[model samples]
Target chain A: MSKIKVVHYINQFFAGIGGEEKADTPAELHKGEVIGPGMAFQKGFGEEAEIIATIVCGDSYFNENIDKAKAEILEWVKDLAPDLFVAGPAFNAGRYGVACGTIATAVQEELGIKSMTGMYVENPGADMYKNKVYILETRDSAAGMRQAVKSMTAFALKYGKGEKIGASVEDGYMNQGIRVNFFEKERGSARAVKMLIAKLNDKPFTTEYPMPVFDKVDPMPAVKDMAHAKIAIVTSGGIVAKGNPDHIESSSASKFGEYDIEGLCDLDESTHETAHGGFDPVYANYDSDRVIPVDVLCDLEKEGVIGKLHTKFYSTVGNGTAVASSKKYGAEIAKLLKADGVDAVILTST
Target chain B: MVKEIERAGFPVAHICTVTPISMTVGANRIIPAIAIPHPLGNPALDKDEEKALRRKIVMNALNALQTDIDGQKVFEG
Candidate 1:
C-alpha cells in the first residue's frame, strides 16, 4: 500500500511557541515538518502514513478571529489535499480544542476529506463537533498524551485506508448519537423478549442508548439581598483540615468533610489544607482559604455585606469523583444548610 | 453538584476557574474562580493583597446569589 499523506494541526504552544503569551499568534503552515505531538503521531503511523505538512495556529487568534482563521486554514488544507486531516489531542485547553475540532469538522464537511480530532470527552468542542466529525476520546490533561496519540493514530490509519469504521465504543471515539443499521440474527420481537427475560432473570443487558437524556432545570430567582444573606461554603476543591481527618479519599471521595469555622476568621496552612490530588497543591497547601475563602467570608460578614457566615462548611474532593457521588453530597449539604437557615452558598471547585 | 444544590432549593453560586466547563455542565449561577487549584484566591500575591482578592471573589459570589437569572450566568469579581 502507498503511504497515505496526512496533515497535522496544533496550537502555538505545541508548536514550541510561548504559552498564553503567544496564544494570539496568527495561523501558519509548515511543509514537511513534524511538530510536538506530530512526532509521536508520525512514529505511530510507522510507514503506513506520512505527515506532509503541519498547520499551526494560536488558540486565541483562531477563536478570536474564527471566520478569518478558518477560511485561511481551509484554503491551506484544500491546497494540501492530504489523505487525512489530524487535529489536536487538545486535552483541556478550551480555545485550542475548539479550534482543532472546528477545523477538522470543516475540512471534512467542505473539502470532502476525512478528518479527525482528539480531546477530552467533556471538552465543549467535543460536544459541538463530535457529531460533525470523528473525535477520539482523550484525557482531560496533556499528561495523557501518549494514550491519546496511540488511539488517534490507529483510527487515522484505518479511516484513511478506506476501512470500515466501527461503533464509537469500539473505536475509542465519542458516540455521535448517529443511528446505524447492523445485522442482527434475531427479529425485533425475539430480541425484545430476550431482553425482557434477561431483565426478569436479573441478567445484564446492554441498552440501545447509553447516555441519559439531560435533565434541564429552570433557573431559580437570585438572592434578593446580600446584606441579609447567611452564606455557606462548599467545595470540590478538597479544602479540608490538615491531615484530612475525615479520611476522604483524594479523588472519588465517598464522603465529604464538615469543618467548623465558628469563630475563626481565617484559614492558614497550619490549620487547614487541601486533600485534592488533581492539580498542583502547593498554593492550596500554603493557604486553604485560597480554595475555600473562609477568610473572605468573615470579612464580608464584618462588612455587613452578608448577615453572617455559616458556622460549618461542607467540602469534598472533585478530582475524578463520579457525578452521582457529587450529587449525593450536594443533596446532603443542601439539607444541612437549609436546616441551619443558610440563605445561600458559595461552592468552589478546582 | 452545584446543580443538585440548586435543585434542593437554596441559592448557590459556583466558583470555578474554568467557567466554560461550568457553563457546559449547566451550572446556573456561576462566579469565575481565580485559579483551578485555588479557586477562591490566588496565593502568588502579597498576603494582604491575596486576602483582598479573595474577599472580592467571595463578594461577587454572594452578589451572584442575590441577582435573578433566567439561565446560566457568570458573575464577575
Candidate 2:
C-alpha cells in the first residue's frame, strides 16, 4: 500500500542550473522535490514508488573535492533513509558520470543503502565503478533519457522491493561479471542448430555469451638503435628478491614489486627466486635469471647491445590475477619506467 | 602489461610461452618462450647451452623492439 521512498541525485546542468560556468556549485538537497529527469523516473515509478528527495551537486565541485562532497552527500542520504538512491543517466559526460558513480557507490557502500546509476558503456566511470555498483547502460547522450529512465526505474523497483535482480542483459544493466541461471524453451542442441543456421543464412542472431572487448593500443615506433637505447625488464613471472622481501603473492597477486638490480649481474637461488604458484619453481629458484634473463641482459649491457639496463625491474605474478588488476599495475609500471627514461621494455611471462 | 607499456609510447617486446595470449592482449611485438616454468631457459640443456638459449631469446626480443610492425607479429628465434 505504501510507495517505496527514493532519493535521486543529479548534476547542476540537469538541475536547471548554469552549465560549465556553474559546475563549481556545491551540494544541495531538495526535500520532497522531483527535478529534471527525476520527473520521468517519478512517472515510471507511478504507483510503486515516489521521489522523496533530490540531491544536486556541481560536477567539478564534486570531483575537485571528492571526499568533502561525498561525506556531505552521505550525511544527507543517511538522514533521508530512502529505500533506493539513484544518480544520473549521465550518458557521455565524463565528469558528471564520474560524480554520479562516486556518489552512488559511496551511498551504497558507506551507508548500507541500495543505489544505482546509468551511463554510456565508454564512460570512464562505467569502467571504474561498474563492478562496485549497479550501472544501467544508456546511450552516449541524454537523447536516450526516456529509455534509460524506464529501464532504471524498473530495476530500482525490483531492488527496492528486495526482489531478485536478473542477468545484466535481461535487466538492461552493464555486465558486472555476475552469472544468473535460467531455463529456456529450447535445449542446447536446438539453440546451437538455430544459431548455426542463422549464421549460415547471414541472419542477425545474438550470442548467448559475448566476448569482452579488448583495448587496442597503437604500436610505438621501433627503437632506432639497440646500441644506444636504454632498455628495461618487466615480468609477470613472479620473480622477486630472495626471501620475497615484498611478499608478492604466489598467485592472484595483489601487488607488484620493483627491485634494484643496479649492481647485480645475475639472479641465483641465493639472490632471487619466484613467487609464482602456477609453475614448477625448481628452474626459476635455481636461477631467477631463467625467468627474467637478467644475466643475459647484463651481458648485453656489457656487449653494448643496449646503452644501459634500468636499475630497477618491475615484477608481479600473473597467476590467477584479474585482468583489470594487471592492467592497473601495467599502467603504473609504465609510468615509472617512462619517468626513468627507459627507451624500451622486454616483458617476460610464465 | 605489454600493451600498457607500449601504449605509454615505448616499444615493448613480449616474450611469453603463450603466444596466443600475447596476441589477444594486443602486444605488437611477440617472441615465444621455451616453456611456462623457465620461459627463457631450457633446463634440459647444459649450463653453457642453457645460457646460450636464453641469450638467443633475449636477442630475439631485442630485435622485435627494433623492427617496425603494422599489427601483432610473432618474431621467431
Candidate 3:
C-alpha cells in the first residue's frame, strides 16, 4: 500500500530557520524535510503517513503580504499534491495561527484535499477560519505540543483514510459553530429534567447550548436641558404609518421605516398601526402612540417641556432579527439622526 | 439598537415592559412601560385614566433623557 503523502506547514521558528529576528524570511518549500515540530508529528504518524514536504514562511512576511504569500503557497501545495495538508499547532502566535488557517483553508478549498491546523481558542485566526478548517484546540504556548500532535496525527490519519470525522467534542477539536446531530441514550426532555435537578441541588451541570456573549457598551452622558433640547423618537416595536407602507417584516424586521411626524400631535388608529408579529397588535393598532409615545412627545413639545420634537421617527421590528442586520440598521439610523441635529432619542420597544 | 444609538453620542431613553432585556442590552436610561402590547396606555382603565398613565410615562422618558447618568439607570414613572 502507498503511504499517505502529507505536506506540513510551519513558521520560521518551527522550521529551525530563526525566531523573531528571521521573521521577515520569504516562503520556502523543503522536499522530504521534517522541520522542528514535524519530527514529533512524524513519529506520531508512524508508518501510516509520511511527511513528504514542509512549507515554511516568516510570520511577519506572510501576514504583511497575505495575498502574495497565499498565491505562492498555493502554487507549492498544488505541485506537491499531497494526500493530507497539516499546518501548524500555532498555539497563541497571532500571525502564525492566521497563516496556518489561511493556507490550510486554501489548500482544502483550492486543491480539494483534507487540511487541518491547531491553535489556541482566543487567537484571532481561530474566529476567522475555525468554520472553514479542522482546527485542533491547543494550549496558549508550545508546551502542549505532545498532546496537540497526538490529536492532530490521529485526525489526519482518519481523514487521509477517508473515514468520517466525528463531532468536535468527540474528536478533540474546537467547536466551529456547526450543529451536529446524534441520538442520545436519554430523550431531550429527560436530559433537561436531570440537568434542572442537578442545578437545583447546587451541583454542576453542562448546558447543551451555551449562550453567546454580548458587548457591554458604556453609557453616554445624559442630555442636560429638556426645555431646549432637540429630541427624536425611535422604536423596535414595529410602529409604522398606517397600511404598513414600507412592508417591513412583521417579525424579523428586514428594514426600518422613517415617517414624517412634523406637525402631527397624536397617532390614532386611522394614521398608524404596528407591523410587529411578536405581540398582540390590537392595542397598538388601536392607538399607535401606545408603542411609540409620539402623542406624549408632541404634548411635551407644546408644553415647552422639550424644545422640539424631531419631524421624523425611525421604526423597526426587532423580533427574531439577526444581530448582524440589527447592527447595520442601528449604524445607519444613528448617522441619519446625528445629521438631522437630533440631540436625544426616546427608544420604545415591546 | 439602543446601544447603537447611545454609541452614536445621542442619549436615549428606552421604554419597554421587558426592563431586564433592556438593562441586559446596555441601554443607559430605562423607563418602565405599562405592558407588552400597550406600553403607554392601560386599556383596562378608563380612557382619561389611561391617558394620565401614558402622560406620566412619557414625562418620565423625557426626564430620563435630561438626567446625567454615568451608567445604566432605571427611571421611575
Candidate 4:
C-alpha cells in the first residue's frame, strides 16, 4: 500500500566525503538526499522502496570505537522508520565489508529488520558475518556494481513485499550454513542416501553444498630450542572476564587485550568470559581456562622446563574472522614478540 | 605462508588439529591436536587428564623443534 522505506549505510569513500583521513568520522544521518551507491539503489528500486535516509561513517572511526559507532548509528536509524537496510557492494575491500557486515548484523538483530550487503568471497567479511546477515556474493571489482545493486535491491523488494525468500547462496547472500525449518517436498535422509549411493556408484552427484576451503597455510620451521624455549599461548576462544568487561567484540575483532595473571594460577567464572561467536558460548563460559588453558600454560611455565613465560598473552575472537586479517594480526603480534626477544611461541587455537 | 616465514629463517612448528590438512598443505613439522576448537586438551576430560594430554602434545611439539627432517613431518607418540 505504501512505499517501502529504506535506509542505506555506506563507508567514507562511497559517501563522497574523503579517504583514510576521514575514516574516523562519526555516524551522520541525512534525509531526502541520496549519496554514492544510494543513487544507484534509488534508481534500481524505483518507486517500490524509497531511500528515506543515508547513514555514513568512516571505517576507521567505527573500527576504533565500535561501541560508540554502533550506538550513534543506531540512534540515527531509530527515527528513519526504514523497513529494510542495505550496505555496500563492498567488493573485495576488507574494511568496508567488515563495516557493512557489522552494521547489517546489528541492524537485523537489534531492529528486527532485514539487512543486506554485497561483498566478494575474499573480503573476509563474508566469512565472518555471512551466517548472521544476507551478504550477496559479488565480484572483486566495482565492475559488478550495477548487477550487484540490482540483485540486492531485488532481494530487498522481496523482503519488503513480505514474500518468502529462498536460501542464502540461492538468494545471492553468502550461505551461513544455517538450517531453516521448512516443509520439503522430498524426504531429507532418503534424498541424502540416494545421493550417497549415486556418488558411490561413480555417478556424478553434487553435494547439497560444499564447504569453502580455508587457505592452506604451511607450517614454519621448528624452533631451534624447544626444550629451553619460552612459549606463549594465544586463543580466539574469547577467554576474558566474567562479563567480558574488556568489551571485546564477538566477531571480526580489531582489539586484543591481555589479562594479567602473574601471581594468580587459575581462572574462575567470576574472573573470565568468552567473546568468541564461532562456538557454543555455554561451555567456554563455565571454564574460561578451558578455552585458552592459561592455567596449564602457567603450570608449565612454573615447572622451569622452559624459560620464563611472557607476562602478557594475546587474545581476540577468531570466529568469523577473515584469514587475511588474521594473518596480518599474527604478523603484528609476531613482530611484537620478536621485539621483546621472545624465543619461541606455542600459539594455541580453539 | 609458514614456509615463507621459515625461509625468512625463524624455525616454527605447528600444533594443529587437522594433521591431514596440515600435512597435505605441507607443514614442516606437525603435532596433532584432539579437535579444531580445543587443540591441546579436551575440556570434557578431568584437569589432570587434560594436563597430561597437553603436556604430551607440547612435548611432541618441543621434539619437533629439535628433530631434523627432509620434508613435512608428523610427530607420533
For candidate 1, give the lDDT. Answer: 0.85
- Native contacts kept (model 1): 0.80
- Measured by DockQ, the strongest candidate is 1
For candidate 2, the per-residue lDDT at B38 reads 79
TM-score of each: 0.73, 0.53, 0.52, 0.52
TM-score of chain B of 4: 0.87
Q: Which is better, 1 or 4, measured by TM-score?
A: 1
TM-score of chain A, predicted model 1, versus the true chain A, to 2 decimals: 0.68
Candidate 1 lDDT over residue span A142-175, tens digit each: 8999999999999999999999999888998998
Query: Which regions of candidate 4 fall more than 4 Å away from where they truly are?
Result: A181-205, A209-350, B1-77
Off by over 4 Å in 2: A216-350, B1-77
How well is each residue in B1-77 modelled by candidate 2, as lDDT tens digits?
88888888999999987565566567889998887677899879998999999999999999889899888899988
Report the lDDT tens digits of candidate 2 across residue range A1-350.
68999999999999998765577689999999999999999999989999999999987677657789999999999999998999998986666878888899999998999999999886667887898899999987788998899889999999999998888877888889876677899998999899999999999998887898768998899999889998999999999999999999986689999999998998898999999875668889999988999899899999998999999999999765666788899999999998999999999987
How big is the positional error of residue A166 in model 1, measured in Å on the Cα after superposition?
Answer: 4.7
Residue lDDT tens for model 1, B1-77: 78888888877898887676677777888888765556766666898898888878876877788788888888777
Model 3: residues with Cα > 4 Å off, grouped in runs: A214-350, B1-77
- TM-score, chain A, per candidate? 0.68, 0.61, 0.61, 0.60
lDDT by residue (A2-63, candidate 3, tens digit) is: 78999999999898887655776899999989998899989988899999999999876776
Mark the 10 consecutive residues where model 1 chain A has the least summed lDDT: A209-218
Candidate 1 is scored at a TM of 0.73
Worst 10 residues of 4 chain B by lDDT: B1-10
What interface RMSD does each of the candidate structures achieve?
A: 3.1, 9.2, 10.0, 7.5
